[model samples]
Target chain A: MAVRADDIPVPRGRPRLAGRVREWLDQESILGPVFVTPALLLLVLLVAYPFLMALYFAMSNAFIGRPSEFIGIRNFVRLWDSDAFRQTFQNAFVFTGIAVAFKLVFGICLALLLNEQLWFKRFIRGAVLLPWVIPTALSTLGWWWMFNSLYSVVNWTGIAVGFMDPPGPNWLGQKYYAMTAVVTVNVWRGLPFFAITILAGLVAIPRELYEAAEADGAGPVARFWLITLPLLKPVLAIVVLFSTIFTFSDFNIVYVLTRGGPINSTHLFATLSRVVGIDTGRIGEGAAISLYLFPLLVFVVWAQLRFVRKQAY
Target chain B: MEPIRRRRFLTTAAGGLAGILATRVPPARGQQREVSYLCWNNFAPASDKKLAEIGQRFTRDTGIKLKIDHVSHMGPQQAKYASEVQTQAGHDLVEMRMHFPWLYEPQLVDVSDVVGELEKKYGKAISSAYEGAHVNGVWRAVPQYHGMFVATYREDLFKKASLKVPDTWEDLYTVGKELKKMGNPVGIPISQNYDSISTAGPVLWSFGGMEVDKDGKTVRINSPATAQTIEWYKKMFRDCMEPEVLSWSDASNNESIQQGKAGWIHNPVSAYIVAKQRKLVTADGINHHRSLGGPQGRHETDTPRHIGIWKFSKNVEPAKEWIRYLLGKREVYDEYIMSGDAFNLPVYDKLQDHPVLRTDPKYAALRGEGVQYHTYGWPAPPSDKVQLITNTYLLPNMLAKAVTGTSTKDAIAWAEIEMRKILAG
Candidate 1:
């Protein structure tokens, strides 16, 4: 029963225009592209355009409000000579390394604790996400107030409790202490994200493995070490990957807390880029600073995703 | 005169619209005739409110509609201007701070005529304003107002201690030691902020050290004068100030004095103005003295704000009208200046003795009779490179390093290298 299009009966009150549209939409190739066109357009306009522009700016001698020319990799090469840029490069690693490590350890413990049968589990789980739920800049301002040199409530409380000497440590005034303050705030803000994602991974782990381990006369520690740890590898990998990128590019905490101060000790790539590019009107150098880590980040993403796929298969 | 018909009306309307679009010109009925201005959120909140009110009145008096927008004074304001310039769009006018006119000279419309007229009426613009808005022998922007750094101190404490008002930076150091012993340390910030640069510039200039030579190319931070300036700061940080100044924001010094912690601070009169407005206990105790002098001469940092019209703006004429209305009219300008509570002052020679100064006794320090006020880069022309040095916090960082235990010579060497790199680039 091969039917021609002309031989098919048209429905009553269906206009020819509507019928033609319906026929076009019924085809997979037409409908697929039609549905995806808006999203593809948005991605091109929003993400790809800016990224390509930044790429161009990074390689060119672009100053704000002035005509620029493409100058090869000179901007990228020149940034290496700057002490601030070098300091920023080192700071980015130290900040991300310490902040992410703390988040991972704390996240696992929190997720493990959350997995147990506890009272008011739903309420407790919701409450744990408060740091991540609030806006980063707004929440960081609260942290700034706590760490302020003049009106630091942290020092006041510590002195009141006899836990610290009067006036306490200059958290934001000293380079090391400023770095510590920024990292502590970063970990506090990012922990909820890691914990919640790890919790989801924890929920998906089958109970049968633990039961089998227990039947084999395995202890609680042995069961967790052999079963729970191995199963959470892929999820942990994904969480760490995201956290590393986010932490490396972090701007708000350090900006509000130190403004990359105490001698550029806490400047991440993003804040340094803003200083060189926007504040100083050297958009070329600024873009270069921002994109300096792009290739490395891309490699990290690729390697992590490949590892994730290997685990999946 | 023919009677209108439906077909004729449609044809006429379509043709007119096509003509207007092709020519990129609107018909009389289609033109909105509006201009927008972008400025910073003033330290005095009332000034921002007064600006809005004046904008409304300007709209009512003139046919042109005016819109005013304010941004946070520090990072966000510069970012906003950069974005606008990059996009070739945004507000028609921007309130530029200090050497911003030089930074965006190409994009700013030449408003020499407006500036010339105002100059004739109000004597010449002050030296700092002239340095700021006058770029490459042309008026790139109209000088609006200036806020100068003055020595804000506790008068009551001085009276109680029977101390002489310090006339020189060295004298202040002598008095500052006693003030610290009395539990109120000097609150000069050595941080990465404009205020840090503000105090550092005057201190450096008064000691006759400049970041760059007047040629705007030679790195001059490595000088005997700079060493003396650093030595002054090192001693000040060690004895007269606390470690907290290293972390202070622009507002922190103001808060330190207003909260009765800081005995003296190099700042504008905003601190006392804010305290008086809030009826703080320290308001009565606070008074300002003329900016302190050094062995060379008296000097201070002047923050002159200007209005610049973007080259891309279609409403240039309307924008100029707004500027003339706000700044050219003496009474309107005075009303606006009065709202700033002496934090904002006239930047013209004739209007230097503004009535706002007479309103408060604490504002007398702002007169700065013998002090030579300069923007961030004093001897050096405020070119983009000099601005870069200021924006990079090289001066403050250099002082910071010195005060924090890096030898003054090493700090000066570091700053000289950094400045030379910027200048060469």
Candidate 2:
């Protein structure tokens, strides 16, 4: 037998295993797949699988722990007849619309304010994120106490300041007030995300643009309207898109605060889905309720991304 | 030594893997036997502690290691059950409340044998327990204990105002008015919560209202009886309770009475038990009254809890052993019940007069004399449809709508349509 390198026996240990792994990874195709396999597995297990399961469940009469039959679009169609579902559908739009609008406006103002050379800028910036950083469920519990009918600090303060009647508004009890309270908490918790992200966008705006505008005799308002607003469009569009989806799907604030209560006025699709699916064991209906907005949301994402691309390029 | 080729190595590895797969057992089969039980954090905290202590004793005596986990009673517990059932995995045993056995019938192990042994040793399980766990003529769970809703009121406040304890739902309105005027409103939650349904169920049943007929198909929410229930709630909402009742959770009523804010609340004895346990200032002042009656009959909401073994559990025998150890033994069962401070009462007919009731004179109302206790959606079996009606909160929402300005007729119509839709679906 001619001496062959292949006939040589290497050490039977980690080095051999490591050598095999290194050899496999050295190939471009193998390396690409090896790197992607984990993320692909994760997406399949965590996201894609659940999403497809939800889609199937939405089309079937899937009760928890029970045999189910395919019911086609009946679940989706039947959901329309429910007053609660109707209210939830309307509430999702209202909640997302109002919350995103407020977050955008307030986020911009706060970002501008933070962009200034204020004292303790770093501390102020960090403090602004407190609402967003704290666990939503835990923080919402605090807001629940403040909005509690029996012991409302907001009511107490309002009374102390002689700003309202003796008894303050039933923040989480009545329909309109409960919606306002939930929207208010959503805005509070979400403002920091908008502020920080917009601030990054604000910072990325070259100082030269403002200086040139100023030199052109443009007032501060004019400069902002002409330069800053146009430049921030992409960031704002992306932010608004994410915020809209998030607000529509918000669960904790409504669940911990009002539980979509006072006649389901504050119910978002997420809470309604929970009530229908897990609480009631109508997993099919719950899935339908949650996925009801999927088409609309997809449109929103596509439209906003298109807007962003337009601005970016 | 011969050098191993990749093909030979893969062949041997594949053979070993196939052997393991065919056997359907882990390669390391020397692990100790263990059983895990998932229960809710009992309203009486001491009961949870007692459960853990008993679990340790179970391990020591049976040599089967036991693990216990508790989630919150209502929403979280239900969510946990759904997740477990959907995944076909989790703890081997679960504590089921009310109609959960019906909802999770397919997933639960048939424990008729265990329940039969328990019934022979103790007595027949209470009607509520039977209704809850006896699914489709099979015992899906072993009846553990029950906590019936009672009228928890401030005795001191009633004495101060010289107000008569409410005997009926109508009488409650009268006293409720005085209670509100005294700045301590009656706290019967009418929101999207089980407590809301708990109170609403009794009130509706008393007024001869049934959400669904006994057949469990007809939507009877539009009946005159239901309208009467809604009207009563509207006035009660206007004159007696605060707008806060419209936003209360299961714990809100408990907290209201415990904190001396509400003069009265409809809840289990857990409210007073917690107050007494915590030595709150209002503990001594709080007392229980029998559940109020309605025009149809005296009906109350009973929350019966049971222990169930999952069908998917490999350690079924060990799981059953834990239940037998916890509830099968008389002394152990009594000790466990006593630890609840009357919040968790024995569900057996023989133990109805459990000494835990005598633990405090305040618990006397838990006796629920002559008050027919049923779970939510009574008159109709706790089928999945009835449960859907209950969970959808049609009852509370109807009352909420009526109280919030929607016409009683309109609200009742809305609820009827919703109920019929669910039943038809």
Using lDDT as the measure, the top candidate is 1
Candidate 2 backbone collisions, by pair? B206-B295
Per-candidate TM-scores read 0.96, 0.93
> Can you write out model 2's per-residue Cα lDDT over B117-219, one digit (the tens) per residue?
9999888999999988998899999999999998989999999999999999999999999999999998999898888999898998998988888888888
For model 2 chain A, give the 10-residue run with minimal summed lDDT. A164-173
Writing each residue's lDDT as its tens digit, candidate 1 over B1-425 gives 88999999999999998999899988988687899999999999999999999999999999889989999997999999999999998999999998888889899999999999999999999999999999999999999999988999999999999988899999999999999999999989999888999999888888888888899998988899999999999999998999999998888999999999999998988888889999999999999998888878999999999999999999999999999999999999999999999989998889999999999877888888999989988888898788888878999999999999899989999999888888887
Candidate 1: regions farther than 4 A off: A1-26, B1-9, B18-25
User: Which DockQ values do the candidates obtain, in the order shown?
Assistant: 0.74, 0.69
Runs in model 2 deviating more than 4 A are A1-37, B1-32
For every candidate, the chain B TM-score is 0.96, 0.92
